[model samples]
Target: MHLELAVATDLPALHSLVESAYRGDSARAGWTHEADLLGGQRTDLAALQIMLDDPAQRVLVLRDGDRLDACVALANRGNGTVYVGMVTVAPRLQARGLGRLMLSASEEQAVRLFGATRIEMTVISQRTELIAWYERRGYRLSGERRPFPADDPRFGLPRRDDLEFTVLEKPL
Candidate 1:
């Protein structure tokens, strides 16, 4: 459960881990998957590289030896809050509590690395189970709705036109 700052070396495995955790037939093994709502790739390597290159952001990973078990990205919003995204775990290893562990680590990293006082994330509104999971982790709806990037197939191809995001936040 040692969390480390992701490097360029982690891109390929990280890409696979994320896609498998959220899309395609592989994601069905995990309860947190978005397979029912979206199609295509969850994320791509180029996008991951950009996140890693951003000075105000970091992609953190937890690994077991050579295994890329989990990863989450944190971006310093410069307003005492950090944006959390791409929370991922190995699909086959989901429900084993690794998501929680990654989240806790991300929170600690947020506070320690960016001096953040708050953490925020956006989840698809259609994902009730995932939203509830975050709520149980102390996140609450901010009542703000963001339209899903329907044009951005880089993340995923939406299955429904009503897809949108709900902001979730927690105080550190």
Candidate 2:
């Protein structure tokens, strides 16, 4: 397996992978599924395309031969920190440590490219298990909360009105 920085040309596969890993029935094959909490698609192709085209953002993709096994997006926060998001590993390949590999690669990229000392991400407050997974990987809750965008269909159709995010941070 090898990891590569994704380009705009990878938007389609990345979109499909992100959706399959987080939403819909295919997501159920993995422990990370949010299908029960969100009804709509997790992301759209256009938004991903925009992200790919952004000069300040990079989508790191992990490939197992010809397939994309995992991926994550890293954005420069302009404060010596990198914001990581859209982390996904192929549902069928979950629990095989691909997520950890992608995360470690992202951290390395952040430090090497931006001289960042910290990497941060936001997780849905209700995703206790997911948060615990991150904690096990050395991230900690930063006591910061952000209101989940209720009106943003691009995120997902929240099953409850109380959805919010808790910031998690880890030093590189």
Candidate 3:
């Protein structure tokens, strides 16, 4: 399998893929989606473009020819750390181990691209299954709780008000 950095032309597909993996009925086909917990867009094209433009950030995509299969975003937090987010796999491709492959690749890229020794991410506090998944991958909860951006439409429209984030970290 090959993983490559997403380009400008990939933004639209990235947006659609992320939405399919995180919202609407299409997302329900996947085990890793937030369809029941949220509504609205997962992310906007502008935000994606900004990541593409940033020297310290990258969105890696795994593709089957011209079709996107999976993606993960990483940001160099500096000081030997990188932040991982936006882990996504096509709904049809879920439960087939693609998410794990993508995540492993992301960790490799984090170290390769940024010389990172640690990687971190935030998951919704209510996603127990997801947190367990990460734990199996060696990430531990850092006990840091962050308020979800409930007021930010750029992220999503929360269906509930109790949403919050718990930070998870691992040494690469």
Candidate 4:
């Protein structure tokens, strides 16, 4: 696998990969699917453009040959912390160590580019398996909670009412 910062031309592919990993029937092939709790696009091109335009943010992609297989977004918060999100892996490629590698690369890039002291992320509070995966990688619950954007179609239409985020952090 190869790792690199994603360019504008990669947005569409990245967008599709992310959506396939989180929404729709295609996502059901992977363990990370959130389609059961939400229904709609996982991400849109406009939001991706905004992220690409942010100077403090980096969208990293992991490629197998010429195909984009995984990606994650990292933003330096200017407070010695990097916020990580939108971690996506091709459904068929999930559970093959790609997610772990992509996350590690993102953290390394955060430290290299911004001298980050820690990396933080938010996961759906009810995703026990997902949270455990992060914990195995050294992340710990930070005792913080944020309401899921239920009113935002840009995120997703909540299928269930009990949706919230739990913050997770790891020292870099």
In model 2, state the lDDT of residue 120: 98
The Cα RMSD in angstroms, rounded to one decimal, for candidate 2 relative to the true structure is 0.9
Per-model TM-score, in order, reads 0.98, 0.97, 0.98, 0.98
User: Tens digits of per-residue lDDT for model 1 on 94-132?
Assistant: 899999999999999999999999999999999998999
* Cα lDDT of model 3 by residue, 1-172, tens digit: 5789999999999999999999999999989999877898899899999999999999999988988889999999999999999999999999899989989999999999999999999999999999999999999999999999999987888999999999999999
Query: What's the residue-level lDDT of 73 in candidate 1?
Result: 96
Tell me the spans in candidate 1 whose CA falls farther than 4 Å from its real position. none
- lDDT of predicted model 3: 0.94
Q: Over all chains combined, what TM-score does candidate 1 have?
A: 0.98
Candidate order by decreasing lDDT: 3, 1, 4, 2
Among all windows of 10 consecutive residues in model 2, the one with the lowest summed lDDT is 47-56
lDDT (Cα, 0-100) at 61 in candidate 3? 96
Clash count for each candidate, listed in order shown:
0, 0, 0, 0
Per-residue lDDT of model 4, residues 1-172, tens digit only? 7788888999889898999999999999999989999999788999998899999998999888878999999998988999999989999989999899889898899999889999999999989999999999999999999999999999998899999999999998
* Model with the higher lDDT, candidate 1 or 3: 3
The C-alpha stretches of model 2 lying farther than 4 A from their native spots are none
